[model samples]
Target: MTGANGVPEGFVPLPTSAFVEHLGGLYHAPEAPEHTFGMRVGPEHANVRGRAHGGFLATAVDVATSRGARAAMGDGSGVSTVTMTMDYLAPVDVGEWIQLVTTVDRVGGRTVFATCRVTAGDRLVARGSVVLARIRPRA
Candidate 1:
């Protein structure tokens, strides 16, 4: 029951930028209560110690929280991270598949707050909180 490239059966490619594309592959499972984002760590994502870099884990959290904010705000409402705080709980090694479970904490008139738990396989690796400014187009 695996999808393309062996991602979980429910996950599909998420909307992303060139920078995210460079991170290997990103997937999303919208059917989850709090949408899940996933990626398999690659050699380039590792630090000199051969562990997944903090920057890479930060990016994963950022993307998950940002997307969670946008989903909470509904379609046509874009979001930009205003503040992000991350707690590194454990180290993840290269080649491990990591998944981020994002939950929207609140959605206000012009901002959204979200949090995420990052896991590699069954081990919790990180947790993050993000505040996103909602961007709406002017008429």
Candidate 2:
């Protein structure tokens, strides 16, 4: 994180104007090891149990992994997620801040693999892996 509520270096915040903005304060930094992301838990992101919903966590993983893929592919190569898998290990409550650390595992001819781990401070909350297939260039 840079300053007050600022994202990490090379990371960008997903403003309220974007679709995933509903996730609330999502951010991602594509740099190695810095493939980092953060979001503060809010009321809307919680479930009846008052903890962050599974969907919310899953969505965050998707956003982080997908964007990290783009950074890995650079300017020209295109990719789209083919599958994603996540494991929930703990719950996150409102007012808590969670960060997603992701890495591009591999980029083959037609597939890319990414993995993410979500944590609240040092507590592991969730882990995810995503597979993205190359998108054919238009003629």
Q: Pick the candidate with the highest TM-score.
A: 1
| Candidate 2 lDDT over residue span 13-127, tens digit each | 6553366775666765545465777887889989999999999999888888876777667757677779999899998998777888878999888889999999997899999
The candidate 2 region of ten consecutive residues with least summed lDDT is: 1-10
Alpha-carbon RMSD, candidate 1: 1.5
The digit string of per-residue lDDT tens for model 1 on 32-76 reads: 777799998889999999999999999999988887777766777
Structure candidate 2, residue pairs in collision: none
Q: Candidate 2 — what's its lDDT?
A: 0.80
lDDT of 1 at 126: 96
C-alpha TM-scores of all predictions: 0.92, 0.83
Winning candidate number (lDDT): 1
